[model samples]
Target: MPKLSNDKNSVCSLAQKQCCIRSLNSIRCDSGVTSAKAGRSCEGDDGNSCMDDSYQVCCSCCALGLWMRRQGQGCDADLHLGPSCGHVFLTCCEEVEARSQLPLRGQENLKPTVLPRRGNGLCSQRCSTAGGRVLCSCFPGFFLMKDGHTCEGEAQYYVDECAMRKDRCGKDFLCENTPGSFKCIPKQKCLSGFTQDAHGNCVDINECSSLAQPCSSSFACVNTVGSFNCQQKVLVCNRGYHTSPDGASCADVDECQMGSHACGVGQICHNLPGSYRCDCQTGYQFDALRKVCTDVNECWSYPGRLCAQTCENTVGSYLCTCTAGFILASDQKNCEDINECDQKPCSQECVNMHGSYQCYCRQGYYLHEDGLTCEDIDECSQSIGKLCAFQCVNVVGSYLCACPPHGYVMSANGHTCTDVDECKVGSHNCSSEKTCFNLQGGFRCLSFDCPHNYKKVSSTYCERINCAPNSFDCQNSPLRITYYTLSFQSNILTPAQIFRMGPSPVYAGDHVIISITSGNEENYFSTRKLNSFTGAVYIQRKVREPKDFLIEVEMKLLRRGTVTSFLARLYVFFTPSSI
Candidate 1:
């Protein structure tokens, strides 16, 4: 009842004129705000502000707000409706300024414009009647029809697999899925003192099976995912056993008996049962405590027992072994006897005894007379293999193992049988001093000749010739006979005494002892280095050329005794200056 105005379309013709006036005055034209304020704004009323009562104000250009409206376009300018009605197209300058604002509503008769947003696609999800069909809705108080087009008491996820029984659901309600359909599921449990038969009908579980849950302290029972559980209590010994009294109390058990303890080597025993197990004694261990039977090294008591050779712990026990030369003992506590002899006894023989063995030689053989050795003996007469002779010398425990005849003898190195050169292969060699002439069993190299620059003083030695002119004439000199006073001696004595003659170079001379201080004693006789004898003196050696002796004397060599002990070892060396 305030006021009324009309002729809205006619304003389009006036728009250019109104815009020109705005430019001339540098003022703004506001069809929206100015219309709302003046209620009918008259742009050229000079200073008078005017308003039209029949026009609608608009705010945006994006929602088709700039388009003019037709009377039958579901809207009437008489009432002014719809989001986009009659707003002028904003120019570039105005759009730049209005860009910060939200899309504007231009008509009041438009349904309450809900600016849901592009991403949500609100229009697509909203249900509406389409193609002669209406969408379903869960209304406040209506039961539903067979299709989703009607509301029901309650809705449920329907299973399409049982579509055969589409409209009606039976007793049990199972969920199902379908495009615009659902079904009811049934109940499988009862609240009352009710019971269900087979076929998955509601029933009661037998709690009497203890299924509801029942057990003592040493036992356990757990409810299952859908049921219950029951377990037996673990049994234990009363005072000293793994078994209970009435066979019923759970008590501490002594694991030391019943052979339950699988102790290792050097370990004592223990036992357990029922809810029982084994354990090693003091210095041993249960491998995992899981099975007390399995023992391992605690090694606290017997230090070296574990690694005597290398003791390795095993499942039920540890083992004690010996080092290469040692063995496990009977008590199993210490290392004991091992037979090194069984493996190698020096060489030829092996004998094993408690802790050791002794080596011995066999017949036709002799130990080297040294505890460390064994030597072959010669038993030629007893056994041809011993020596190559009819006579066999048995010495000590065995005969000589030698090759003696046929000009051959055992070599100095013992084992080798070497050929005798008659000069080099025999026990005694009469070499250049004697004669190298081959003989029966061996050979003889005997030389009785006087050496150069020396005259034969005795059969075993020579002397330098020096005398007053015409003292005595040798066989090769002038024929003159003369006597000589001789002095000869020997510092050493041999097992066999021999004869010695000296001080005379030829047979034409005779010898005599001037004096003696009991010449019977060996040391007294050789005092002046004078010759003494214990064996009969043979004539001066005269065989061959330049014999060792041509002396004129007589003496004897005792066959029974010889001197051995001596203070100084003297070497009586004589070189022949002439012979």
Candidate 2:
């Protein structure tokens, strides 16, 4: 029975005689393998310790008296029943961790030891389907059972650094793999505004404006994804609303009068941030000093362009300029009607009012163009005031009931002064021998008929021919008469003493007839045709010793021809009587 060998020098000389027979039965041999036969097996030895030492050679192998206890052998102190109950006992307990190295049994063919060990004890070690089935040894997250029947230090691998990354767990994990363990468990998310935070890591929960959304009566609640939708954004659905799906619910955005928003038209709507604007119920706004939407420019309450042409800007404000000659109206603000009669501006009749227009002129007229329109101006044609002093007459709109023509009358009210009598109502024919005077505003006709010896001197008097027969004697006999008359009526004398007269004046004894009488029929020639002169009526001849009687008078001067006028009458007749 001792010839058995897995040869390595016969198993190192039978492992030194099986360690000197378990140190002479002081027993302690277990590096695992066993089988039994009335065994006291400190487990480990393939052929089942050589088939239990071949029955210990037929019974000596501790035959029932159980004594193969080696190493300093102190035999049998417990776990009894070792007396061949068909001889099978197995025990193995191991602890070898010193830089670990245990890789033994592999000559291949060994499989049937189907695991079943739960802390069993006994030196009855039959863990042998050929040497690898003696199991028991553990430590770092352990697990070993190839029929080595169980050794488990596991359950400790929750090692979380988000290991192996599969959907990264931890909101209460669920990745469970056991052998060398792996765990995590709880997952199912979906909340923020109702959906889609697709694992960018949980926690987001918006449920769309939250409060479980059933919105609609003027509704609202926008929480997407895991559910909540309903939105009719504004107005009407009072006391706890319940109509949804476009009918409205949750109600209350009316920040103050909102057909939903845009507060403009006497405004008010202020929900804030995610939307809602327009504001003006406290006396209006955005008018930043009349920049628009209005309520304030109080015209600055005091000074400037505020309304002469218009500026009525009020509410919180304004007034003034709504009347004179008017202008303002394009909203420079208020008081309009500026048709100052359509801008023709007006020199006269323009009175349009509201903001202003009144230039005046129509009764018997006055004003032309500059004040604009009511023109009709003829104060008798611009004679304005001197009015007909001499000629003016321009009527239609005014002036001219005339005056000035020697007799001057127009004063009964056609604007003026009177006096045209030429002497008491006979209206002047003057010559039944003179005088008709009524002056100041015209009339004076006077005639005296002082011819024959000329001496009236009253009634517009006359005195010429002072002749008492002083000596213009002519005896040439056609009548033998020698008459010389008194001189007289004279604008100074000699056209032959004016046709040989003595009073109507013309001398030298008359009969020296010289005739070409046309200075307007030259009778006393009406004062030389009233001073526009060139008068001459003549007859000449009286020259016999008067020491100086050169009375030469020949005439005709209209385009001039034949004319003479000489008069040297020094007929003093003698005057040296005394010193």
lDDT by candidate, in order shown: 0.34, 0.35
**Candidate 2's C-alpha lDDT?**
0.35
What are the per-residue Cα lDDT tens digits for candidate 1 across 1-579?
111112223222232335323332232334433332222322122221211111111212112221222112321322222211222322211233332242333232322111111111111111233454433222111233454322222111222535555546665566564433454556556655345575756654454353433554445565543355556555644455444444445545545554444454445544444334333564345555444433444443454435433454545455665544467767664565576666665444333332344344433344353433556656545554534222345678856545545655565745444445554445564544554533323443444455443476444345444545654433222122122211111211122112322221111223323222222322322322243321122222212221122232222122224211101111111111110
The residue-by-residue lDDT of candidate 2 on 456-489, one tens digit each, is 5343234444334543432110111121111211
What TM-score would every model get versus the actual structure?
A: 0.17, 0.17
What ranges in model 1 sit over 4 Å off? 1-167, 170-185, 188-239, 242-252, 255-579
- So what's the TM-score on candidate 1? 0.17
CA error at residue 219 for candidate 1, angstroms: 4.3
Per lDDT, the best of the predicted structures is 2
